[model samples]
Target: MTLHRTAILCLTLTAGAASAEQLADLHLNIVPRTDAEAARIASVIAPTTDFTQPEKFEDNSAGAATVRPRANADAFSQASGNMSFERELDFKLGNGLFKKLWVSSPSSTLASDGLGPLYNARSCQRCHLKDGRGHPPETADDSAVSLLIRVSVPAPTAAEIEGYFATMPDPTYGGQIQDFGIAGHPAEATVNVTYSEEAVALSDGEVAHLRTPTFTLTNPGYGAFRDDLMISPRIAPQMIGLGLLEAIPAADILANADPDDADGDGISGKAQIVMSAVYDQPMLGRFGLKAGKPSIWEQSAGAFAGDIGISTTLHPAGYGDCTEAQTACRTAPDGATEVHDNAEIGDDGLTLVTFYSQNLGVPARRDLNNTQVLRGKQVFYETGCIDCHTPKHVTHRLEDQPEQSFQLIWPYSDLLLHDMGPGLADKRPDGRADGQEWRTPPLWGIGLTQQVSGHSNFLHDGRARSLLEAVLWHGGEAAPHRQAVIDMPKPDRDALIRFLESL
Candidate 1:
C-alpha cells in the first residue's frame, strides 16, 4: 500500500477494521503528512488546559478560512476568507445556482425546468435559508420548507434482513414524503406535528420546559403505508466549514471511535461507515444529520434530487424520488437535455454548487475573552463535553483545496454517531446510525442561529427552542453530562451556556 508512515501510525492508534488500503482510497486527493508535519499537528490539536485566557487562534474557528462575522442575517453566507479572487467568481456563480428556482418541465424555461413531480423545496436556499440552519413549521399556516419527513420500511426478504443495511424505502411513497409537487401531480403527504411540554426543576430553583414532538403523516396522496413503516424527521443543518470537515483525515475521525467504551468513559462514539456515492467504496460518513452521506459532493447532489427534484449526474433520475408505483410522476417531463449531460442540474452545475457549499466560511468566534465565557469554557471542559464534541482537528494538506489545506479548525464535533437515547430517538435507522444514534453536530456558528435564520429552533427535528433546551434533550451517552449541567450551580450553568454562545 502507498499509505504514509504517519497515517499508518494514526491508524494503528485507533481501534477499527479500517485497513491502510481503505484510508488510502479515501485520501487520494490529499498529500500525506510528513513525520515532522505530523508531530507539529499532534501538538497543535491537543486539548488546551489554560482556561485563564483564550487559546492561540481560538477566535479563528476555521483558521485561514474563517470569514469575518457579519452583523446581519448574511453572517453565514460569506465565502472562504482565504479563497482567491478568481475562485470567488465561481463561488458567486455557484451561489446563483444554489438559489435558482426551477419551474415545472414542459415550460419555456428549458434550462431551469424539471421542478419535481414531488419535492419539499424549490431551491437549496429555500430550505437552508441564508446558508443557516432550518427550522420546523412554527404554526399551522407556516410552510414546511426546511423540515422533511423521511419514510422507510423494514427489509422484507430474509436475505435483506440478514444483510442488515437493507432498510428499504416505502413501496409507493419512496424514501421521503414530499409535501409539494408540480401543477398536475399530487403531494405525497402532509407532515403534522404536535408537541407536549414537560418542565424540569434545576439547581438554584430554575425551571426549563422541554417540548416532545409527535409527528404523523396526514392526507396521504399514495395509499396507506406498510404495517412496519419507520419514519424520521430532519431539518437542514447550517452550511459552513464543510470543506474543513471533509479534509479531517478519516484516520483521525476513526481514532475517536470507541464503539465499546473500553476505557469506560461512558461515551462511545462509533464511526458511521457508508458506501461512497462518488468513490463506490466504504468511506467515513461525515455529512447529514446522521452522517449518512460520505462527501459534500454527494450531499449536494442528494439535496438537489431529494429536496428540489432536480436530477444531477450523481442522481440521474429526472423524475426525482418518484417510485415505480407513481406512474404519473414517473412519466412526467424532466429538464434533461444532451447539452447539460442529460440531467436537469448537470455535472457542471452540481460541481459549482458543491464548490459554493465547501467554501462557506465559518464566522470567527465571539467574546472569547469574556470572563463569563471563559468560566463557561472551563465548565464545559470539566463537564466532559469534549469526549464527543471534540474541540479541534487539523485538515490535510490538499493540493486542490487551498482554503481548507492543513489548517486547525474548531468544528466542535467528533463526526461520530452516538445513541442520544429514546427521548431524542426517531426509531428510524439511517445507514449505520440506529434510531437513537445521531452525529454530534458541529457547534460552531450555533450562537448565530437567531441572528442568521431568524429563529433558534435546533436538533434533528427543530424541537429545541434554545441552547439550554437543546442540552436538556441530550440523553444516552450524554445523559451524565446533561445531568452535570442540571446539577451544577446556576452560575456555572449560565456560564456554560455563555461559553457555548461564544463559539
Candidate 2:
C-alpha cells in the first residue's frame, strides 16, 4: 500500500470504502494540505499532535480532504488535491455510479435498473445536486424530490432498539414518506409544507423573521396514515470531507462530550450511539441529520433502499421498504434475482458509489485571512458556537487509508448531538436523539451551497433561509450563543456572517 507522509500530516493509503451528498460505510481517513515542498512530505514527517491543545495557526492545508479550495459551480466535484493516480481512476468510477440514474425494475438496462416501486429520487446526484446540500421547495407546487419526510410513531418498550433503530415505521406508508412511485404504482402521499413567519427582534433592533414549517400529508394515494403518526423532514447535506469526518478518533469526539453540562458551559453534546451491523456492535452514529447512522456505508445503503428504493446487501429486502400492507407493491417484479442474490444494488455498484463519496474533496477556505471573515471567526468563538460545532479534528491512522489518514481537519463540527431547542424540532425521535436534538453538522463547504445547489436554505428541515437564520434559531444548549450574536452591533453581525461565508 502506498502512503503519503508529510511534515505536518500523514495520509494513509486510500484503499477504499466511504460521504453526504454522504456512503455504505465509506470508512476512509484524510490527508493534509500544505504549501510546503515535496521533500517535506516525503521525509521527516511529524508525529500526531495533541487534539486537546490543537494547533492555533491556520495552515494552508487544513487537513487533506477537508480543505480543497475550488470556487465555481463545479467546486464540489473536485477530488482531493493529493489523491493518488490509482484512486483518481476509482473516484471517477464512483462518480459514474453516484450520478447514474436508476430506472424502474425489469428494465433493459440491467446495470442501472431497479428503481423503487416507491422512491423519492432516481439518482443520488439528483438530490445532492452537484455534490452539494439540498433545499426545501420554494412553493407547494414545487417538487419535493430533494426533501423527504421520515414517518414514525413512539416505539413500545418491547420494540427492538438494537440493529433496527428506534421508532416504528408507519405500517402502511413505511419509514420514509415517498411522494413518487414507479410508472403504475401510486405514490404514498404528497408533502405540502406551509410556513408561518415570526419576527425575532435582536438587541440592536434588527429583526430576524423565522419561518416555522408545517408539513401536511396531502393527496394520500395509498391508505390513510396512522392517526398518531409523527413526521420529520430532512434535506440532503453537502458531500465534502466525509472521509476525514469518519476518521476522527472516537475518543477525541467523546472527550468533547458534556452530556450532563457538568462544566457549566450550558452546551452539552451527546454522542449518538446506535447499533451497528457493520462493526457487529454499537458504534457512534456519524452521518445523517440526527447522526442516526454509524458509518457512511450504512448511510449509503440506507439511502439506496430508502431514497431510491434500490436494495443493497445491507438492506436485502426486494420490496424497497414496502411493508406487508402494500401487498401488490411488495409482489411487484424486482431488479434482484437469483444471480445477484436478492440485492437490487450489487456489491460492486455499492463499492463504486462509496468510493466516490469517500473522496469528494473539501474546498479550501476561500478567504480565511480576510478582515471581516477573521473577525467573524473570533465572534464565532466568542459566541460559543464552536462549543458544539467544534472546530478541528484529526483523522485516525487506519492502515491502507492514507487519503483520510492522520491529518488535521477543520470541518467545524463535533459530530455530537445537541438539543437545538423547540424552534427546529420535528417532534419525532430518532435513535437516542429526541425531537429537538440534532447532530452538529459540518460547515466545510456551506458557503458554496448556492454556487452548486442554487439555494442556501439550511437546518435539518431546511427552515433557516440563511446562516444567520440558522444561528438565530439555535436554542436549548446554544441559546446563550444565539443571544450573543443577536446582541452584536450591525458591523459585528455582518462580520460574523462574512466569516461563515468564508467557510
Candidate 3:
C-alpha cells in the first residue's frame, strides 16, 4: 500500500478532532533558542571534557626534565607515550563468548545456570542481534512477538522503603504466559494476530493501505488471565554507543527535564527516576523506551535475569510458572540464584558483555555528503523531526584510555521520555514514566539495522513494518510533526525517507 493512503486510514481510525493550526501552536516554543540554552537544555549532549588539548596535572609534571623518563625509570611513563590502536580495537570488539551469549541461546534452554524457566528469548542476541534493528510483522508466523512485559503495584503512602521486589511484582504464570518453554513442558502460550485493513484515498487520487493489529492468545497452558494485567510487547532496540550514553553526566540529563509541561510544549520531556540495581540509588533513567534503568550495566543485567533466566549479582534468582504437580520444576533450582563456582562467569562476565555492548563502535556515516541525504537531513529538521531526534553529543574523557578519549559523536536522541499518545501507548507505567511516555530512540546506524539486526521493525514493539509506518505511528507530542510529514509532497516525503535511509 502507498504511504499516503495508509496514513489516511490510520488518521480515520484514531486522529484527534483538533484543527491543524491549534495543534501546531501547541508546544511550538518549547525548543531552545541560543546554542548556550540549547546546550543547557540538552546538557546531556555537552562534551564532558575539554578535548582541545591533552590534560596536564601539576603534581605529575617533572620539573625541567631534559629527557622523558626511560622504560626502567617508570612503567607508567613507558605506557603513556606508546599507544596500541590494535589493542584498543580488540578491547572494543566484543568477546566471542559474550557475542555467543547475546546470540546463540534459544528462549528455552536449561543450562542449570542460564537460559530461562521463563523468558522472552533464549539469548540477548536473539532480540537484538548484531545490536541492530528488528523486522516488523509481515507474515503471521514471522510477526515480531517478543515484547517487554511491565507490572506495577500502588506506591506506599507511608515512610517505609519498600523491599527490592515489592514495587514490581512478577505476573502470575498463567497470567502472562511465556510463549516458549523447555523441552518437557507444553509451550505455555501462543499469540495469534488478526489484521483489520483500512483503505484511504489520498489527495493525489492514490490509495494507502493500513492494518490494525488485534492480538489473541489461544490454548494457554494456564487457565484464563486477568484483564487488568497490562501487557506491552517491545521489540528489541539497537545497541550502539551506549557507553558514551552512560558516560553522559546525570546533571546534563536533568538539565533537560520539563516534567510539568511548564513551557506548554505538550511535549513534556520528563525524566524517569528509577532505583538502580547496580548503584543502589535513585537515578535519572537514560535507557529503555520509558528510561526505566539508569545505566547499560543494569539494563544488560536485568535482561539476563528477566529475558534469559541468567542470574547475576544484580538479579540472583530465576522465574518460571510451574505448578506443585510439576515435581522436577518445583524441586530443581530453576535458575542460578547466585554466582556459581566460576567467579569469572558471574557479574564479571556480565560486565564484560555490557562493555562489549556499550563500546560497539558506531560505523561512520554513509552517503553523508550525497544530495539525497542532504535533502533528507534538511526535510528531517524542517518537519520538526529534529525536536526529539537532537543529533550530536561529545563523550566524556576516559582515564587512561587513548582511543575512547573525548570525541564528538552523533547519536540522534534526546534521551528523555515524551508522551507518544494513545497510538503507541501500551497503557503500562514503567519506573517514573507514565503509560504514554517513551524515550526517543537513537537514530545512529538506523539505516543499517536490517543488515545488522536482520529486521526492520521500528518503535517499542514491531508494529510499524517500515520507516514510513514508524513515522505515521507518531502521536502526542509528535502528532503535529507526524501530520506535517503526512501532508508533505511525495518528493519531499521521499526525500525525508532517503535521509533516514542514509542515516
Best by lDDT: 1
Q: How much lDDT does candidate 2 score?
A: 0.75
Off-target runs (Cα >4 Å) in candidate 3 are 1-94, 101-113, 143-167, 174-177, 185-187, 199-207, 318-330, 334-345, 400-405
TM-score of 3: 0.73
Clashes of each: 0, 29, 15
Over 53-94, each residue of candidate 1 has an lDDT whose tens digit, in order, gives: 999999999999999999999999999999999889889988
Question: Candidates 2 and 3: which is better by TM-score?
Answer: 2
Task: Rank the candidate models, highest lDDT first.
Answer: 1, 2, 3
User: What is the model-wide C-alpha lDDT for candidate 1?
Assistant: 0.86
Q: Return the clash pairs for model 1, or none.
A: none
C-alpha RMSD between model 2 and the true structure: 7.3
lDDT of 3 at 276: 53
| Over 4 Å off, model 1 | 1-22, 157-165
Candidate 3 lDDT, tens digit per residue, 211-256? 5666565675655555555566666677656665665444444545
